[model samples]
Target: MNKKIINKYTSDNQASNLPDYQQCYQHFKWPSVTTQLNIAYQAIDSHLNTSNENKIALRWLGKQNQCVDFTYRDLAEQTSRFASVLNTLGLESGSRIFSLAGRLPLLYIAALGTLKAGCVFTPLFSAFGPEPIRSRMEIGEANVLVTTMSLYRKKVAKWWQELPHLKAILLIDGAGVLDDGCYALSKLMENANAGLPCVKTSPDDMALLHFTSGTTGKPKGVVHVHQAVVAHKSSAYYALDLHATDIYWCTADPGWVTGTTYGIIAPLCLGATMIVDEAEFEVERWYQILDQQQVNVWYSAPTAIRMLMKAGNEIRTKYDLSHLRFIASVGEPLNPEAVVWSERVLGLPFHDNWWQTETGAIMIANYASMPIKPGAMGLPLPGIEAGIVKRTNKESEQATLEVLSEANQIGELALKQGWPSMFRGYLHQNEKYQHCFTQGWYLSGDLAYRDEQGYYWFVGRADDLIKSSGHLIGPFEVESALMEHEDVIEVGVIGIPDDIAGEVVKAYVTLKSGVIPSEQLQKQLKGFARKKLGAAVAPKEIVFRQNLPKTRSGKIMRRLLKARELGLPQGDISTLESDEQ
Candidate 1:
């Protein structure tokens, strides 16, 4: 298969971009490596400090009916003040600060403030339970933390007494009322200088640390530098078709890398407005925002789209969604069915895209004007080079890594290195970091075969594959088949520990609306799967559920499912829903 980007830009340094104020945009100029990260600094000075300061950047809503709007100017001043406090507290550059809070503005403040102060910021999943949260904080060696009063009083309230590395906790809503031991964020910011000087930082300076969802036990910290943000902006602009006038609402939570990239920096870097909602996924509420906010480019996950499809088209048809220009999918690969359903009901094909938390932004995507196939993850964006490598046949007559140059061949997808947003490293884990790459090619654990048309077809994770009766089966293929059943709203397939066939596929499924829980429905669904794909790939066992556990970004936690099935420790339950808990 050929590389994804049809065109490549000559070097102008890796941090280049067209002026945000340009009247007409044509070709994009990628920034050189020597490009200044002061773009973010200047944005704070120009668009934010002027007439648009009153323009809202985020609309945070609460479960208790409280609402708050943060304008760009408000964000700048608050972050600047917090920067002053951070410096005064002896927090130096490179000092890591791990932060968590229920979808709120303080998460943004702490992140930007940490960066403005020349310190690195790490985000922990707000939904993570105590152990997972503590694991990340301890692993990151975060000297300070910023969170809500309730989270501090309930979660970290006991953590401080245990893990001593987290020296300080800054509470957003607990000011004045918080325990004397914990610092009040509002009071500190009030005491700080709003005119605090911005620190001069290199593009390569450690900017953010995100924890990857480890299919294997412990979560690994992925490090991204300040320069990576610029890379994220360039790629996100093209991949997601984000424009200055575009009112983009990225549904990813701040707890994930996509949230920090698209929801925060990418929009600000280009001087575009970003929408933030503090509420959880509610189909009717989501459509209401699309109409009210006029969200132009909608980027969410396949899981969300499926959930939306289940809600039916009545709510979708009610909205005057003429404003929505494009839609895209992430987190998990989008099924062909979801793509078609989105176009029929939402009035547009929800484009499928692929990327990892480590990569920062969309590396491969189906853009607004790009040609899109129903099931294929479209071409790689400009500046990214990819190829498929056939699995090592230990029993091969001749030995070599035969990169597939022909169509209809399945192989491992690997990226050519030196991309700006490529993760710097796994924090505190050198050997572990080295495992994902060979030479410079980042070995994406995903197995995808490239077609002659330059589109990539996803197989499942390298580990999620099951070998049954000596035949290899991708869990996604089986899971997708199961999802076709009307009774199956969600499905997760794993190779159960089996005796004879080496491994047997067992599907854990969630029922859809109007489907009453009964063995008859389960039997019919299993029979349907058998007729659809063949008995070999059909689930040996069918387990029904009220809901499938998912991350805040709407990705089903497959590892969590596998962990639970074998009575093993469920890894990184931080993103697990409260209802699940």
Candidate 2:
């Protein structure tokens, strides 16, 4: 029999003596699962039935500093009209709709409208170049695409016809006559009725498709169901201390899971007023937005927090953040320094939380009411069961995973597989999806440990992917892109520690036989990578290496590369073939 460890943070579980899962399910009110459920209806239409119909659902800030406020009623009408347009276009139920825009109102409308239409909504980062956009759309079998005209012309125009499955390309900000196969989004909305009925959807129906990169392959698409709304609402209420009427802002792009889950769905489900800024991260502007918007609850990434820290205290002191009560950081682990900095400067400690694209929602979080553990990732959300497990059979493809009972033992972080928000499976990758779970636990590739108080601490990734500025960059993806360049023969990419970003992508490359590693060549390679993979996934620094450490099987030892770069202890490496000194 396996040993299970359940540590108690508080001694109040007397009535039922039930586990956290039962306690949470019994404590919170979940929508009736027996009836049909649509995330859009739960997020928008339900609010419309309440007295809060006129309440502000979204406050969108335009690029020119213009503001547009959408009430629950207004949002419902807009989303219904968009859904009507989708139906008019002959898109079938369960069709996949992809959004390739930024934090615009139209993108949010498209997301919810797609959900209301019973179409799976997948969002891509607006900064993504032609290839990433094309690959994701192709993988998800995207039926309808909603994006701006400029993005279409810049990124999608060339490849739009290549995807046979893509039927419609709706341009949100298009003016003048529509392109050959494209339609103006605003004109379609104008022509459609605003009273379309929401599609009846089962809880298990696919609602969202999110793409995340692995260390060694193309991006994997994770599927989430409409039932995920249950966990999202509960987590937002408990983890974020979000309240109805509270002005909230989450600094994540709609392209990412955090953006879709928290930025759009969670706040709306809570009936909170959400602030959306159409601008990049500038310290002064962010401070001004916080003050002017009177934001009560704020969620951001560790990279942004560190950047704010770099901006110094004088800039922050000038702004009035008196309205701010809670601030939380996600995307990556929040360093202890940033947490302390937030407490001292921002007047509140930045709560840290942990989750993945596969989890579909936040699994563990530092609550607003709980005592702060600066660097710890906090306890599992009431219903989530997290454990540290060791692979007892690493040599076999099918390994035996044993959950560690002792506290503070370093091992892979694994979560029990029953969360409502947990991803159903990786799209079209049944074997890969099955490989992720063993002994009924979803193995998170991250290495972490939990303290006796149940606070989980992040160690490092078990894989070689780089997380820079809250974006996951696969070394394989970057390496493959760099290998496309004429001068590069082989490349090993690793993340190096930085004060601002938790890690920055750094590449160590070996040139082709005749090609010399010159400064000009390095610059050209960097430019090529930026062009191919986009700046976010491109390597920030490049170093010329005679050769990269590899195993006898020719697998690049990224761990050795990272260890050598960071001057960290190089653990046992008896299988090493050779090192380039």
Candidate 3:
């Protein structure tokens, strides 16, 4: 955990898809684009003629211990039936379909079926309240909604009538009293033909619309096209180390970008078996799934990892996880302690990666065949070109960029344009989308630096930097240091206004299960942080909390903490999953 590089692990018989990074990057080529390029065809129907047709495509575990499996042929037929249902409803190509439900078997079918019919698909968090659901549906101009009867009644029943573009509502769980334009999905699928052909689509045709929340505005819809599957297939092959025979499990809900890109599309494109659990995060339940289902490759977020760390290592000893090979973490920066802890307790280090909703695919990652530097974002993917740059003009119509040359020079992270999965544009916000690029580089708002060996390290977000007495501080550095403390389980740092300095660092801490919170322990933590980091970089003030504000995808809401502390407006709490007491 002392910034020491973990050497890559190799077996005598097994080989990685990317044996050497440079060689693969030099010879990498995108798949040829044909006239009829559809994601559904690539992910599902194309496997119909191969041996993968009989392989289990999905294994769904219900909340009540009900287990169901769907093979490639079953998926093709069910998705085709769903497409025919859409066709029978008079929905044309390019129509928008939005789904709001938990991880049900039918939800997966609906998603692939929507893409098969050449309609745009968007998935909403089932836990979202009424306002968030209404706003996203309104912004995306939802033409069809797929949900359960309970969700429709609780969240969408009252306000859905106001949306003019909504034409149909298909309830997965049939309702006793149906409203206008509402029909049970089972009834529609009963008579629909299962031989519906996949619609022909251009590479650039819109296939998915993912909404991302901003700090002070309505949710911005990020548009992605059918061509994204090319990047999806390649990135998964190299980054996730996925193979046709692997049992893959990505524990992200389809509401967020990671869930859709990796959880649903990427694995399917490679013909890998996917494990989907309809229950929320429970340490014992998750361990049971890994041991019983024999998942080979596991993709998860840092929040769940921290939760498991908090649960202690005793539970893991009861389960046999010999089948698990590679584990990867995303959604946020993985703390160095988590990486070290996983390696010691779980027998494999969690390889951290970097990407955003706009990218629509993994850009930087610690590959299975590469050495890992704890707390680093790893190297850029084979096809990605990443750099650090500084802005030249702040208040001019034509701003410019200066690419930093020296290593360890902190600057905004930027990516060279023209990646296939790169978002085409923001829906109805062309000006905003155009502002994201300058000199052919898409500016990522996150701040980062690269070491001499080309390993990228994440600083906090650009706006999250702390300027105290002429010293620039990234909250991630301070949080990682504090996380080394044995008593601290989770930490969220923010900059608070000070009289002498412009801004000072303030940290909110969540302690371990049995640790008592006393002023002496707080002072000890401050001293420990000061020892790890210098006085200027350490937290000026520390506060104890039961939990920190987080999104449904498990990213800490540092901006929310700063706003609540300063009594400023808490903009866009729609995605807020939990709040600190």
- TM-score to native of every candidate shown: 0.74, 0.94, 0.80
RMSD of each: 12.5, 4.4, 11.4
Which one wins by lDDT: 1 or 3? 3
Ten contiguous residues with the weakest lDDT in model 2: 1-10
| RMSD from true fold, candidate 2 | 4.4
Candidate 2 segments exceeding 4 Å error? 1-32
Per-candidate clash tally: 12, 0, 0
Range of the 10 consecutive residues with the lowest summed lDDT in candidate 1: 6-15
Q: Per-residue lDDT for 311-384 in model 1, tens only? A: 87787878889999888877666767777677678778788888877777778887665556767787777777
**Tens-place lDDT digits, model 3, residues 521-578:** 9999998887556464689899999999999998889989998999999999999996
Candidate 1 vs. true structure, TM-score: 0.74
Model 1 bad stretches (over 4 Å): 1-29, 35-55, 62-67, 391-400, 464-581
Tens digits of per-residue lDDT, candidate 2, 368-416, equal 6566677779888877778999988788977898889999899999998
TM-score of 3: 0.80
lDDT of 2 at 229: 95
Rank candidates by lDDT, best first: 2, 3, 1
Ranking by TM-score: 2, 3, 1
lDDT against the true structure, each candidate: 0.73, 0.88, 0.87
Maximum-TM-score candidate: 2
